[model samples]
Target: MATFSSKTFNSALYLSFRPGYNADFYKMLYDYHMRNNGQFDTAVDVGTGTGQVACVLAEKFKHVHGVDASAIMLASAVQKPNIKYHVSNGEDLNMIPSSSVDVLTVAQALHWFDHPRLFSEVKRVLKPHGTFAAVGYSFVMLENHPRASKRVYCLGNEPDQLGTFWDNGRLIVQNLYRSIEVPLKNVERHYFPDESGSELPLMMENVTMNHFRNHIKTWSSYKNYSEKHPDRPDIVDKTVDAILEEENLKEEDEVTLIWPTVLILAENNA
Candidate 1:
């Protein structure tokens, strides 16, 4: 299936609802780059929806480039003075000079790309030893609410539920330790769950019915469903109501939501 990550329907919904990356996550990226002796001389964020991550890149580089297929998204990103924005799909990197980018990253928008095409272009644009990374994040509904298990399918089928984007980073360390050599050095720092199981601490959020309703607008499923079923009454509201009624979630209630992110980094494999 095609993806909704471009600036139009996907981006409109994303900017309206998607949460920004956490400082912890941001620090990890910086630390990785620094550890690897990588510098952000020139950076690009592909599929720069609403420019959220691009804004962060601006702080590191002399100037950052944000590119997307959607002009609307580029326009939004253009508002950043140090961040140049372009409306070019990743499949065609002709606009970007070869070996010009030091760090190339994609956030929450990787699955939408034609990966073979994108990977090839990334190799072309990145200088030797340059790092390419992709990171994604997702809501932890089950972590957010114990009762959310009943709605696992809803969460799984989300248009943007790419890469099971929910890991605590520490868990990644654990898995790597199990599989590969520890303290695995050598050109290091160059690399690198849809389930809500029992008794996990809630990634809680302050939520009332209205607050939850507002969040509905942030959901692509809710947005698409609304467009298809405008006369069908508000299914999102009904879903929220059902959850609230069943869980007895009151105005003062906060529910835990799970959010996991997967970060992948590799030297250009050309």
Candidate 2:
């Protein structure tokens, strides 16, 4: 697993800028196990950055334990009943009891883990046939505008400062985890479902440019660029400005963004 520098990862800005996984995403996770007649009482959210996925699991599971490597990131996680946050590496989940977890989830952070060791730990903690999901989302896309959308896509995709700052883990996500080997059996991609367990139309609308800019600024690559090129501190500002000018948009102008999420679902089969 790659070690993240607290200096590079700004937990405060990350909590503020990163989009939260919606209820639909949680519903799919909860139902994945239940639909298979597996238990749904306890869940362990590995690499539970800011406790987003763990908090969601708390609604369905009797207990939800969130474990992360960074203390700074865990500090930003919200406190809630039925939810506990712990500082631990994904590969070593010795704090959790064996065959005790009903569901194990790693949201947006699986790419950073030592997959084989993490899978072994997950299997140790999960009951037979327990669900394991690794969730990731594609680059944020802007709707209702072509020029601005293309520019944002280019910023994330093309070899620029942001591109150079991205770590190897990012490549796995960009490939939708296709290249990464999964040690678990019967793994497949799962989609988000509404509260009723039906597919929900994935959509977002009326997002302010400020909010969009904030999301871009939260990218690890962008943050890394900011740290290395402190002298070129205006890159973020200048980038956002260019988008606004090119799109003839005001700061408050509402734009639509679509973040297509992918999930790698598997069963413990213990």
Candidate 3:
């Protein structure tokens, strides 16, 4: 989390490589909220890196706020008439008025939060029966290429690689936020590509190898490893090269990348 706050962090690269939630995903979220009598007057997106989620919420909510502890990240947020950006952590949302938010979201960020404090804040700011959604995606798998997928997985799991560089919060994300307990009521968990064979439209198809490499470069673990081993050949480049060799492909060749995604939703019934 602190890696993203660093001034040296590449916010542009992060925004460019990170996939945004599609309309169907947002429709499902809004439908759940509406079915539970949730309002749409105001929404807040905590830990809103680059304001991607907030920008989408702005289209439906009358007022939307994108909050993050990183000023450098907020600087790159998309500007919209109905959206505002704030520099604050999820645990302390004192700037937002109590019981004023209709829906609160934390995308790819809930794992880094102090859960108790953040949940307390969520209850304080969300209206009665308001929605609280937490969304994140786990490891990316190369479709139809098991060897390349394993290489990508090992890059972040093998101790000699970027494994040790990741923050402890990453484990929670990898587990699909199963350990997280939202104090709100009517809690539900949904997964893309569930075990029962259900699938969501989250996969990236025909993506250039270079684009995929750039995505790996945006990882915090990769950044940490590069800083510590400045003299070593770039691990990202090496990993991409190894992947290409394993699959007999060129950088311009297109491949499919699938990310196992999770969305947990609850209502602030309290």
- Index of the highest-TM-score prediction: 3
Give the per-residue lDDT of model 1 (tens digit) for 111-226: 55666788778888887667776665444453446665445435434444312322223233323222222111232322223244332221234444455555555655555555
If scored against the real structure, what TM-score would every candidate get?
0.73, 0.90, 0.97
Candidate 1's C-alpha lDDT?
Answer: 0.60
lDDT of 2 by residue, 155-258 (tens): 87777647767766887877667766777778877543234656443434457999888888878777667777888756667778998988888889888787
Superposed Cα deviation of residue 45, candidate 1 (Å): 0.5
Candidate 1 C-alpha error for residue 243, in Å: 1.8
Considering every candidate listed, which one attains the maximal lDDT? Answer: 3
| Full-model lDDT for every candidate | 0.60, 0.78, 0.90
**Model 2 quality (TM-score):** 0.90
**Listing every candidate in turn, what is its Cα RMSD in Å to the true structure after a full C-alpha superposition?**
7.0, 3.5, 1.2
Backbone collision tally, model 3: 0
Consecutive 10-residue window with the lowest summed lDDT within model 2: 192-201
Better of 2 and 3 by TM-score: 3
Query: How far is 268's C-alpha from truth in model 1 (Å)?
Result: 2.3
RMSD of 3: 1.2
